[model samples]
Target: MTTFQKVNRYKKIIQDYINKHPEKNSDDVLKHLLLRHIPLNKDSEQSLQALSKFRTTINPFFRELVKTLKNPEKNIIEVLDIYLKANPIKKNDDFFALLVAYFNSFEDLYTNKDLQNNTALYQQVIVPLHLYRERMEKDKVDLACELLERRPVLKYEDRDLNAINFMSPDYRRISSEYYENQRIKDSVRKDHRLACEMIRTMAIPKKELGRVITDLLKKIDSDDSLVYLIFETLGSLPIPKDQQSIVVTKLLEKVQNSKNRSDSEAAVKALIKIPIPKQQGEQVAGILLENIYSGTYDFRSLVPKLASIEGQLERVVTHAIETASKSKPSSRIFDNSPEYTTHRLACESLKILAGLPILTESLRERAVDVFLILAGYSDQQMYRPALEAFREMTIPESRHEKVVNKLLENVDSKDGIYCSYSCQALAVPTVFEGYHEKIINKLMEKIRDPNGKNIIYFCVALASMPLLEHQHDEVSNRLFELVDTKNSDDFGYTVQQAFRALLKMADSNEEYEKVAAKILEKLDSGDYRVKCSVCNVLRGAVLPERFHVRVVTKLLELIDGKDYTVMNNVCETLGKFPIPTSLVEQVVSKLLPCVDITSGHHSIDKCACEALGNISIPEHQHEVVFNKLYDRIDTFKGSFPQSVKPDACEAIGKINFNALQCPVIFYKLFMRVMNPDNVFETLNRDNMILNTLSALYNKMTPTERINIVARLESMQDDVASKQPNRLPFLLSVIQKCQSINAFSAGLLSHLPAEKAEDVRSGMVR
Candidate 1:
């Protein structure tokens, strides 16, 4: 008979038996057919066609085979052995796909204790895998990765080693025995690549794998891509610290010699991933800094990476400051000298370093001196960088007075730009401890001088400080004179600064009344900037309770004007009022539409949320406000602007669940906290969720708390394994409960042993 006819005849016989024994399951049918010694007719096109048709009729049988292989109690080795021996699936057979599926499911099998202990069974599985590996065309590399990942510690028996040798295309040395053959010298590159892929995919114990990886690193030549891949794999292994330092040093050398930008970037990246010893920290920092100055590559991207090293921060900070301090003005006016260019680069670097979260006392002192000199320089371009560096520095308490005095001295100088920069710097509240009065007097003296063309600078300086109650009257009157007498349009920046300062001094009812009247007068100004300034000043004024009605009336009128900036400012001002219950509906009705608009204007939405949160504080209004915020959160899940969601979360957190008289509120928030799909991953959102849970925890009854805690305990394993931070965050929420309960005990017991003990000790205290 022909091959197709022969296979069809077999199918007919199996179909007849299945029909006769209809009560038998698919497994029984598969075993019966396998026991009959059905021929696969290996590699025949006709047999392949027939088998494809036959597999469709026996689909259930293949599924049953998969289930058996996955069952932990079954001897997987024996099952695979029987199936491979009986069926003898060829590369072209229809059963090959099913077998591949079976291989893919072996991840869980690797975790089985029986498979780990049975060395003989390991031999049985590897025999067929080696055959399959050799036959695989498209998925050969993938199958290799899977095999390594599944059995990373698979013993290298002679048969297994022979299989690896046979699979390599470059293995050309002929010998009577596989182990006796010498590998071709030209195959070293291919061998190294294969070794890296093996090491990367396998979970070989670090002690055994580390040496292999290090030796591979040594054998590779100047092939950047190969070196990069090997370095990445090395990063994953727990190599000894001393060995890691050696790898870091070699990578640094590679970075120095690499002319290819991509290669250099990759080398630097790998170097940073391995922690450098404290003694070697400066060398790494110096090399990276030198690379940055050479301009061969975009080393600016490496600033954050460099800053992450433990001991590199001080050195980087010192180098940048020293470079910037050496800057001097060009001898020829307006000519950009080489020194000027170098100084500019240094100052830019200093700004980046200052922005880093790590700032030592010595570095801060150095930064202060460099910035002060830069600010005092004649070049206007240097002022902004200097001011930025100054703002970022954590000035020591002992140096605060000296720094403030130096800035004040610059403010008294004839250089208008320098004076303004100094004034702005002194505006930081902590800079003027006892010197507030002295600085404010100096600014007022400058503002009072009719010759003071820099009155705008002095106005901004005064506005930046926190005005005390006793000095309010004088500061306010002088600021008012500047805003009214001076044409605000001519110096709009100055007018805004002066008006903002005047409103800040309005602490009492009389002062607020006076400031409100002045702002109301300016609200009619033709200049849009003046109107914007008036709206901004109104935001800061503490209107009296009686004046709230009038203030709200004026703000509502402005809200009708439809200028987004003015309306946004108005919404923020309206939220600050402790409105009477009679006005809640009017206030909420006006604000809700603004919040509901999804036009991507986050500021307006943010202000509306804040206003709604403020008005929703009344006991009777909690449920209505809660539903509104909840619906907004639901409507815009992932597409919402960053600020809107956190604002909504915070607003929802402010609701009084007890006052709402709805027990479901607690459950709803609890579910929202636990739903991983719904949670935003940002730190702000996570913190807001934690805050919301803390709020709900305080209100939850013991039964409700237990339910929540039980859910947390159930999810603890998945969460702890995926995101370790979440466990501590959830524990923090539980800690906020009014009192501990049995739920707490159950939750604690689910934590890892050390963490659970720490939590137990904390609870006792």
Candidate 2:
């Protein structure tokens, strides 16, 4: 078949499937798009290239695709790898348009250990990330709006990505209704009613939603289901920071008196997103706790709602303690499903308060009781958070002496994480408080407890120990022993820490060499902690410059280490040492690979990449790292983590000017970051990007020199109105503009006064 024929054939097949099952198509298109590279054909190539056409064609499916991508085709995700290899851009968000949404769809929220090393997932995640560069060229809004309107036909989930979302009939009805009900629709009350309809129609699950769109429209005008929709769509709306609390107050009043369970539940869930302005949140929490505890209302129905206060942390804490005191404490506190979530809510509330404030004596005491009781929790889901909260609260303080001692006394009786929990908590300041000897002696007493909690306990304890607090102690001696095994995760962490402390206090060769050997023994440890400790010990050691070679070797072991932060971290530590050639090569190679990593292709991996840049030696690694970094910086489409990209950009500019004497790379990387697409998407405010621009301009091309005047002029409005993060980048651009014009005359024998002042009005420097 001809290329167009094949494309048309696939498009028809996809559209046919979408016609049969519309809802399923949303996820399919997203899954298809996130491929490491999208394969655009003769048919869809133009559509991908024309972003406005793509968005309009895809808009109807936007909501559905979001839902599908959210749930994902976990089993069929490998399919994305196939598409990514094709390098197709079906959509664009900002400058880097085309299937960028698909790239995002493939990302898991935090690091996904389950599929971390999976090569197929890697292909699905990175290639399009690389492909995004082509679509990110400079463009005007008219073109953007035009891209949003285009219809590109593509196969996703055996269906046409566009066909499934082509509910023209719904749009017609909505448009007609919009015109007929324009006044009402424009009104706030009707706006609320419309939100209710959207929730009942678009947001709520079909089974739970019960009524159809027409019925929902009538009901939402009077129902509470709209509350959930409002909160869910909160991100899309232009909500003022101050107006949130007031709206929340209204929602609470509505939920408080609502007769419908659905209405009440929706209202409570909506409350989760509202920022409670601390004081207002506390007031609401107080009312909630009192109402639940005073026996005025059955706590059973309100637990989930109360749990929603997790967002308003302080209020949640105050209310939780008050509720516990007001009501009788027993295992049966949560009597039903809704109340069950309430107990979990209280647990969550306590979870947030840990390490925040131990001010409330009674609250801490009760919270400790809650954690202990929950240690045996039947639900593993709740147990994890509760356990985490327990560990957080038990940091090296004796604030809960009675609780810690009580927990420690019974540590041997417990098994699994329960015992681990107690031992780890007891290792804190509370146990060792001015009684270091007593705490050290007690460490071996609970070694028998399973779940390895005691092991974790020692790890944390050793890390938190004061550097000069213990001098040449036996505890340090025991750490030396554990450092030898280096295989156990927790044990390695503990030994590595002890090494960090000893290296600082070690005054003589005897002490330095003693810890160095222990550090070396674990140099082969695959665990990042071991490698890091090995790196740290070698950092300040008086080891001969010859040791710098081995130190570089040890740091290399962590270069591509699974832990994202390990490579950059090792380099950072190594940078501190006075070193030579081998060290320079090793550091350069380690940093270059990070520039290639596309984890920051999404919002998540940016931090790791940024850290890589921060530790980089911009002066030396210039040629080796600059070009590839410039490419990555120029190509990145969406908002990246603030830390990584900026550092990368700054390092690139610095190395370009100081190392390579290439000033042009500066203008290219600067413009790419300054003009990122999706102006409103949350990730764009990477302060690091701006910091890099500012640093670059400050050092080499300050505004007074006015080198890249046009770009600065273009971004002037954005610089003024850009999110808080872009402020620094703008400042640099402006500073450079002003400085260039103010000082541009210095670069030449003959300078024009008119040209100089005009430049001064345009930039910051």
Candidate 3:
């Protein structure tokens, strides 16, 4: 069959099950249904369709499938993944059984005796052998060998070792055990599988693993593998609690004798994980730092993890960074990850340790040279890293204010934006105060410098401008000029953002008028998104007497527009207020048409429901919205995406508190909101529904608030601790209780002393 017809035939089979079973998640059933089709080409739409179809489903089965299959020579994994993804429970009964069924019928081949040879079926068939080997029994393996007609040997050293992907910690040990039992030498034989297996074995038992690795480290030639193994083992294994000094001793020996670059790095890393007593560990760390200090060991990959170590790691990290400054960054330790991210994380870590004294004058000079060398690297986050580390190492803002002032003096064009970012980072409000003028001047020049050719520089430069502002006019003038830019390419988003920054600095009408005018002008702009953007900005603006008339005129006009999104933003923004009786009906009419129609876009739908929340005053419109949400509740069986359903609850959250006649419906809607649905598969996406959920809970009574919190707490055992949001819900309860207690306390304080005492005593009684 053609790939298309064959896939359609399989999809039909899955869909028929969905129609028949209905109980299985739509995604899982579909995966099992689609397993017959395979060799999905990258260019083929089959992958896209399958992903798109199943992305709607909410199970970890697909991720497991991806993990199950990633082999160099295999297509059956994809088929098996889909089958199990569609039928996890069915397949979970026995992965071996599932695999046996999958390979047992190679339909068209039809060689009865070829199938009879269990060895050929298990080994040559290519699908079930590896996965089954990981989990299967000795008896099952014999049966598999009988059917396939070849021994299914999964141990790397015993088979085509080069073909195997790197195994896990368990599988790695398995390979190592197999090799040792056969009396094979890893060095002369060159078995990658055995090497990987040994590496993984080290992760679980560091002292024992460290001892074995010391032997292997003597012979290992590949620095990369040795280093990673050493790093992983150190990173994962616990140091022997009773004999910590032994681990330190082994690591010191490993780093001293280690010829491979990564092996040396691993030895360094493993040393950090060892629990040397503070005074003793400090001495041991000093020794490791001396080796790195002496320029004996090389570190390429373990630098970050090394930098991340506590106690003596600082000495090691500082020494290595210092060493890198002298030696050319031998493509060994040069990392290309985001500079600011690495810098920020490292600084935070250093900051937590009293301070970073390692960044002294000699260190600073070397760091500067390293930054200059690294400037040519392609990754943008690099410069920020250096600046942050420099920021830490440089004397504290209190001690080195003069140094920053001196640096600010060199703010000329010679040093460039990299220097400028570094200087500004050093001079931040907490860091430097007197150099604000020089810093701002440099920022404006960089921001306006068309040839400066740096977007991130300008973006960060502008974002940082308001951080420590003494003068407002120059800042406002600079911001205003950008806002009124006639250039079409100047998408108002950035400048509008700068205006928000300005709002944070502004206090009076004069400041508000200039800011509000810029925002209003954008709202009236021809671009649809700009208009929506304008509404969002204006909604957040302070409603002063001067700006209110202008903002209201455009807002009312926006409410009358056909772009549903703009209208939604307008009505939603307006709903936050006490609606004038006259405009209440107009807003209601604007929202009525959106009542139960699933908005093609979520934002427009959000705006519509938010606006409706103010006044569902019209009777029929109220019934339409309530019933529409009521009917749609069951539309998503188990795997419904919560975004669509969250809105339904949000719309109810608003209407429930407003003038809706159905208190019973509101109560039921609140209960449904409290229930955990499969639609909310992941909590990573911020659903506006939580905003609605919180708002609905707030509008509720003490009993209702308790009801919501109680329901939220029940999901804790089932949901991943990181995934479910318990903090916000718990805070809301505490906040409500505090407010109520404070008000009661204030009222009781007003009574006569005797009566107050009696009241207090009565409470105790």
Candidate 4:
């Protein structure tokens, strides 16, 4: 028949099948027809034309099939057998592609007993695979490797099969006379390569394979390439722990002696796979230290591997500190001195060692001495590393007192950087816990010292302390006394710092109430700066219950005060507290007039929006709050300035739409933000819209969610075309909603693979 006639004939057959099975989609029917017909005329014009028509007529079924077959239950040999039987191509290229597809579908079958017992089926697969490899095509060799490396269910009785023989070359070379004769003819490196590949590919009995691998290791000598291959092979094997220790010992020796960095790194990599016994840790640490000092490899790469070896942490730390101490500071100005290089390496290594979770007291003390020496260096570069190292070290409880004393000595040092670092180190909660009362007394004394220049440092240290509820009254009383008596001209900022600490330390309602009363007293201060600072403190210390009401009343009273700074701070703090349901209307009424963005003071308007957003009420008030926020957004959309729009958007996003069951609000917000003209320019505004949609998603019904996904998909093309950068954000929104429903998840499976992956990873983050 003519080519056109044949193409027409095949198309009719496909169409008839699709018509008969309406439940089966057009794409599925097209896949079945192509699989049946392509192999018969793979290289013919008729088949090529038919393939082109089919491609245009259906979705990409082959890609979907590949993904489906990756699932373990669907990747069975029976499924592959059906496909192979239907698509019987003759051309080698087409046939190899089919074979690869089949091999890739072979899921891990190591524990499939029924398949293991089916000897007949094993023979059927083995004979054809062996013949295909014997053809010796370059691609076929790779295909053979891919198939043989899989965990096969074949038994030892199948050793006679050529496919099995191909995978067992190392075993045959060591244990069989014929293979040994063949190996003698090959180059030494080639033989080693073959043996390593064999070990990697074959599932030989453990006892026999272990003996062969040991013998091979013994034969490996000065050849770095062979040693690298051998170590890599050993890493993949499931050797027993005792055997692993022996392997680690041998690899560590190689790591120390090998001049080649790659070889040493490979040996280290192998050692990491094997567990070193606690007793061997010191020896292992010694060898690693020697390699590190050799300076042949990047020492940073070695630190993590050394850290992974449990036990002997003390030995490693001590060795690292000693090596770092030997690195003298450079004397020359612009020369690349060995001393500088060594010092830098030492500092880096010390930082890593000190950061390790396990540390002995002696090792920590030695590390502290090294850090102090580095910290004392005049150059900021030298001291910054020391500060970082000290910060990471968890000073033991026993050493906290000693460390605190050492830090206190530095607190009065001439160098401001050193004093700052010392104060920061002492600020850590655990370090401060041991000396809380003494530190508080010392800070109070320093704050009271008329000539004391370190009051700021003292106030900061006090703020950093983890004041317990039991100590709250004592600490608050002392700090409050400073605030009450300190002159606003001399120590106003210091007093603010004291109030900051007091606010953080206060825990109970009564404690917060006392703080509130003091704050109210400060609000009446003549100095606007004092009132403003008090307002900032109040933002963080908004009390619960009746105290909240009282605090709100005080903040509201100050909002209309004459000073703009005081009014701004008061409005900002008022917005932060969650106004109760009874007070929502009153609070909203007061804040609404402040929402006028055209008024020169945008801060007041911003704070008003923020406060209104934070107003807490029953579900019944959702529409009220949403409409007020939305009206502000609509009013500002085109005509108003851009700065105020985000405040309005954020305020709208923060409203409790879920409680109000206001899906339509979310839908409208999404459509507005996703408008093609608006999406790219307002990418920063997408977060608020996404959060709104996410809240709506949880409250949506199944059918409603499906409709949402459909709408998103419909607009996806426009989004990609106009705002390609927002595609990931768009997909993330859909994925978050669809992930809860399997039906929606399947519907979204057609999204680009990378985009889908980005969606998943974004959700995980």
Candidate 5:
């Protein structure tokens, strides 16, 4: 027979089977055809080709199959089992899309056992599902909406069924009128109401949302629970502009007059969320100002909202200055005194006011006046916030003279702590530039005094101040002299700060080498404690690249030292330095043995792992380095603690493996991290690996990234069931598959509503 005739015959046979079993969908019919008809026809290839040619005839069947998967009459696992048996039918993109849609239909709230008892079926589908992740990611919104319309809640077992929640006073009335009529109880109606609300909110169209917003607002005066839920719902929806005022009015009433503090807090929170018009920003600011001293609103939340408008911010600062003026400065703070309360409030208010981006000259002067008054009060706790505020002020160069005078006077305070705090505040470059000489002269005078105190703060403040090329030598020579005066226990910190001060002066390659040589000289001549302090300084330093080898060479010698604190400090400091090409062998050789389980030092081992990660290993060294690190991962050896494994995984992941090596490295990481026996450890280790993979992802070639993603996708089940909290992190890494943010926005915009709500809560929680 001709090929056309044969194709026609096969179509007829499949049609007869579908006609006979009217209940069977495309997947079922395909299975029947494969199991029963293909053998009788004895032309598997011909039948398969005919099916592909007449695929359009079966297009409706595929759509019907997706619908069935959405609200399956039978167990979804059993349903998919039949689908998986028909491998030929699974070849098309539609089947893969249907699989992804079906999987996402289940909520993250479902327990692993509730999801799929049939591991075989899940494994079969996950492979192809992952293969089509890119395609589904593009259509994620449409797919979620489609699935929601048919089967709003996907995984609902009898275990989830519970009596209607009558805990809320409104529950019985609402359930009797709404849920009772709909008969949603056989499903997880009571238990998953939030899930229902989330899906309902997501599925609602923009045009329809106005009415929902209005209805939710009308009920804001109900019980506090319902009021919070309504306000939360309002925050998520884009309320109409006309209704925005209604929202603000309702929330304002709650803020000023709600019986419960939580309700007032919630109202203030909701007000912060709704965008106020630029023209009306001052009006909102005025309303908030009216309630500022009412002891009802959270000023911290109100600050950002008011700060959005320049006029509002100025008004806020003006009000803050007025409030500060009400409290008289006293010799000491008292808990019960009204003056103390007012002063405390003023101090807190000034700190918040100081953080604003813009402060008018008059407001700055008044605010500084309040700060100076607060400084004289004997409360040490109150001084730093006020002084820090003084430091943070955005004073133009023309206006800094008075501020410089006040700070300098404080620097000369006989109260040592107060002097140190003032010195700490002078570290701002903008304020310190022209006034460095006056401050330097005062600090030098204090340092030279026999009774001087807080020398460490003086050294730190001097180091942090931006210095010109001509000032470097003078400061370095003074710090070096201080380092030479360090035999006494009281001068140890002074000596360390001196070393830090000298290193901070090195901005040029020659200067850096000079500093490095001086540090080595100290390391060689200094005691164990001095060596430890030097290592600590280098750990936080920006690190000098030109003289990295000399520093690295010195650090390597200290790595194997008997002092635990010094060894760990040395390893951490070494991690901060990029390995110079000439010393890669020397550095790696010295550090590798430190990570060995036999090293007997836990902290040092972890730091060694970090040090290994910080360097760039050549391609030729990838195997030895990867193998050594991989052996430290838990799955390879039981003795390695969870603490060490994550760092080891991090160490291995940071290496730039060749394409041929990417899959192997990822596979090892996946196996090590997917341990179902211990979910907590799995999550922590997975987080470490995924973070490293994400950082390494962009550096890899397109082909290498694709391979890595495919390998990661293959373990989707292990991720979904084993360590689900890490799902967001995994998706984030996978999202790098698409470069543009618009595509990411779509993914977020479609994230199973409740998931999106959780993400929002996580931000503030």
Candidate 6:
């Protein structure tokens, strides 16, 4: 008979026996047919394929069929080759069972000699053999060793090694075999797989590893891949103290001499991980500083490493300041010169100094003085960095007066940029509190000048200062007068700054009421930027109880505006209010429609979805709000903008779902994740849903979590049958639920002894 006809005939016979012996399961019936009519030699590529149509029946028969074979090892290889060729996804239980039977029948499959050089068979059986080694009675460690000796490189070494480790207690043997394979291959050509595996192994001796690195560095110029892999291996593994100088010298040579910028950067990254010898620290810092001067590397990456070297922080800082002082400004209007590079390096250096872990008291004072001097430089770029570094430092309380006097002097400078940054600097802690009167009076003088440059920054500095009750009205009114009401576009930024200042000074409901009145007056000024800014302030500010009603009403009024920006900001503001019971319906009713796909604007829809997350939805309004978000997930049809679904998931988790509603909410979020079309299975989207699931699971009663887990388990079969690709997502949800319950019930510490090490490693990873 033809292969197709013969397969069909076998299928007919199996089905007939199954029908006759309905009392017996399919596995039992398949076993009966295999021993009685279908001989062991009857197996074929087409026959296996036809029998595979009967799930779970082939596994039992494979177990029994292997026992009857004369040359089981050879026959099993044939079966595996045909089966693997047919089903490459390789998740079938029957295929796994066949592998188990194959290993059980052989004392050493590699001992067959015919199979040792069978690369195809070796490649296919390597992963499965390691995986099922625990089930076999024979010690397969030797077989695994032989397999690795022949096939030492794998693309997926992390998974492959993890499987190999399961077979043998001495992983050092497996690791060393792979390392030696790479060493031998390195003479002919570089094998990155072997190199990467060596980096992961903890068994390679320090002297041997150093020799490998030294050899690789000799050929670093000829092969670019060796440069990256060798450095990565060095960075990941700790260098022996005796070999540190040898490696550091070579890397420094690369950093100083190599023309390739990426090579230099990689060398610097590896150097950062190595513990610099105390004697070489200064030399390392000096080389890095030279690169920093040329602007060849990011100073942020280099400076911290420079500071980390013993006693080199001050040298780096001083060099930066001295270099900056010598750079003269270009007389040309648009100049790109070494002068600009020097000034930028200086500014970054100042910021980096403040960020260093240990700045001695003397060095701190010097840093403060140098920053003040650079603040007065004609270069406008130095202003913010100067103040930014000044802000980050904790000026000794004793020096607060001296620092404030210097800053106040700059506040009066004719350089508007310098004066504004000085004002910003004055808002720092002890200085702001100790000298508020002087600082505010100086700023008040600047704000009164209507045409003053950088007035918005001055206003921002003023807003950041806390106000006394007596000074609130005068300072706020002065800022408000600076707003150009008739044509806000001319002063839109300044207007936003003024409104923000008023919002900051509002410490009470009465204070916020005044700010609200100013906001109400500008809401119709035809400038959406102003409207958006005011809404943003309310969105971020903690609205007092007295202002909630008035603000919620105004926000609700703006919710229907045609401008999406205004509507987006308005929805975001309304979300922050603790909507009174009387206004919950109005707020929910307005927001529900905006979260729909028909809204035509993603920003508005996204904001509306997020707004639903924060609203105090009365029990009566939960169903409607949920239904709107439910329609927004696009579980089967990715019709909504991808941005809207995660927000919807967040909003669903935030809802106060009743007993009947929790499961419904979880099912939607879980299944939405399972359906790939929802956000295309983006990691970000999956994480958002996973976080929402975890949070929601935590909120449930222990009993509710149990019921939810049970319900989730019941859907696994449907997921396997219909959407098998998403089995991981389903499994993740179940594991996450169980993990949350374990932690909440204080059972994490009580896990069985065998799993303790695995759990700790998982947590560390």
Best by TM-score: 5
Error of 3 at 9 (Å): 57
TM-scores of all predicted structures: 0.50, 0.47, 0.40, 0.48, 0.60, 0.57
Q: How accurate is candidate 1 locally (lDDT)?
A: 0.59
Please report, in order, the local distance difference test score of every candidate based on alpha carbons: 0.59, 0.46, 0.47, 0.59, 0.60, 0.63
Model 6 misplaced stretches (Cα beyond 4 Å): 1-346, 355-357, 396-406, 409-419, 432-437, 447-473, 487-490, 506-512, 597-602, 618-646, 656-678, 684-686, 701-765
Supply candidate 2's per-residue lDDT for 327.
Answer: 28
* Model 5, C-alpha of 390: deviation from truth (Å): 3.1
- Candidate 2 per-residue lDDT over residues 635-654, each given as its tens digit: 55555533444555655544
RMSD of 6: 16.5
- Report the lDDT tens digits of candidate 1 across residue range 182-254: 2332244444455455454343443354555456466435454466666666655566775767777777877
User: Local error of candidate 3 at 73, Å?
Assistant: 83
2 or 5, greater by TM-score: 5
Which stretch of 10 consecutive residues in model 5 shows the poorest summed lDDT?
A: 102-111
Cα deviation of 108 in candidate 2 (Å)? Answer: 45
lDDT of 4 by residue, 372-438 (tens): 7776665554566677776678655655666666666666666656766766776776655658776
TM-score of 6: 0.57
Candidate 6 residue pairs in clash (backbone atoms < 3 Å) = none
Among all windows of ten consecutive residues in candidate 1, which has the lowest summed lDDT? 148-157
